[model samples]
Target: MEREKIKRIVSKHRHEKAAILAILHEIQEEDKQLETESLNYIAQLLKIPVANVYGLATFYSAFSLGKKGDTKIRVCSGISCHINGADEVNEALKSKFNLEMGETTWDEKFSLEKVHCLGLCSIGPNVAFNLVTYPKLNKERIETIIEILHKRTGDSK
Candidate 1:
């Protein structure tokens, strides 16, 4: 199943000399992370060294080499966010999800991480849930958002 997906992605970008990043991004988007077997298959299909694929995967912060949860949550800890109560927002998320920075929930429903900034300093205390930034938040708003997400997924937890 996975092999066929990789083939399609590679075939889609077959003519490009620097399709490695695009291919990797597409794979990551599908699988939530880059697996070793997938990387090897990509290298073989692309006729490039596995090391080359691995290097790019490891170098990019956007790529997750390990498994990630269905939802990714990033809290901004930049100076502006800090002043605007990002710490409290982060703590609330930790309390609600039972996860620390760079940790995923046991259910694999959510991954919590900390980022320096999202460039929304004016509306500090920004949090990115699944890459969508929500600015000017407090503990209550974040918790409510989490609950809404959980309800949407039909997860009573």
Candidate 2:
């Protein structure tokens, strides 16, 4: 996005911190990461120091300066999941999507991660996207899962 556009968006926040947060959240919702450019633009427009924007972004896991994808894939690596073959599920997702853990794909379709647990151990070998968990998942599920997410987001990637 253009710096001027960001500036205008941030400028709309004025003295309302909540408004500022809301704007930043909207930006991230669209772009995933709040880049340095957006931060600078917000700072310049809001009359707030650039450090402040950076600080806010750093304080929140929701805000990422690194690459982020439309869908967040959190695979279970907990004991129960491991026994249920979560690793196999993880591998299938990785090979199928051609992505490494903690990495977002170039197409920005998915970001893969191994989370501690989604609290549904009985549904071992679980994989979740945006908190929607799929238990007893397998290789065959990858394509359908990605397709579902892409359909939801209207993103072909």
Candidate 3:
């Protein structure tokens, strides 16, 4: 992330003490993940310890220190989702992309992750692609979603 961008985000909050999380969220949203350099710059701008910034970044599941793929897929592993066959959904995705949970593809196009819940239990076995939630997942449905994402991202495979 550029220093100017980080400065702009910090300036948006006027470097307020309470806006730390917001600042980080904006940075992460832009960068897809928090870089070490960005973390250092944020700490300096906020006049806080680097360790503090790092701690907060690591503590939140929303923040990722590693590079993320353009498409992020999160499968719900909550009780309802599990009972509804989330495991099967997960296995299908894993087989489709050759991805394990928390792993990004070598092409940097897709990342697969398991989340505790997506808060949409009425339609269990939910899957979130990027930020869009898909309800009532099955292997076939998941395949369709992946195909759509691939098309949108210009992935032939």
Candidate 4:
């Protein structure tokens, strides 16, 4: 599976060095995270050092070295969100899902992450679930979102 994905991404970018980031992005999109094997494969295909691939992957927050859940939730911790009770919102989510930042639920249905910003400061305290932004979050709203996700994913819990 990893080799096939790498081949497709390499082909898509025509193996150009300039397309490294795009190639990584496509790989991450498919795998939900970049594994060491895939990184080595990318490095071999691009004729770059594995260190270069590793460095690029580690430098970018968009890339994850660990496995991710089907649903990824990112809470904004920017100045605006922090001043607007982002902590409370985060706590509520953690409590509701029994998860911590950078953790996925045991069932692998959801993952929680804290991000610096969602780029929507005007609507502070933003939460994004699978890239869908929820602005001006509160504890009640968090619960609603979790329940909805559970239902949507067909999870009883």
What lDDT does each candidate get?
A: 0.85, 0.77, 0.88, 0.87
Cα displacement (Å) at residue 70, model 4: 1.4
Model 4 lowest lDDT segment of ten? 148-157
Candidate 4 per-residue lDDT, tens place, 81-126, comes to 9999898899998888888899887777788898998899999789
Which ranges of candidate 1 are over 4 A from the true structure? 15-17
What is the Å distance of residue 23 in model 2 from its true position? Answer: 3.9
Task: Give the TM-score comparing model 3 with the true structure, all chains together.
Answer: 0.92
Per-prediction TM-score: 0.87, 0.65, 0.92, 0.92
Cα lDDT tens digits for candidate 3, 56-117:
99998888887677878888999999998898899989988888898888877888888898
Q: Write the candidate numbers in order of decreasing lDDT.
A: 3, 4, 1, 2
Candidate 1 per-residue lDDT over residues 22-49, each given as its tens digit? 9888998889889999988988998889
Tens digits of lDDT, candidate 2, 1-157: 6776676666677646567788888788767788898888777666788998899988875677877777788888899988877777888888766888878988786888777878998877888886578877876776677667667866533
**Residue 117 in model 4: lDDT:** 88
Top model number, lDDT: 3
Summed backbone clashes in each candidate are 0, 0, 0, 0
**C-alpha positional error of residue 81 in candidate 3 after TM-score superposition, expressed in Å:** 0.4
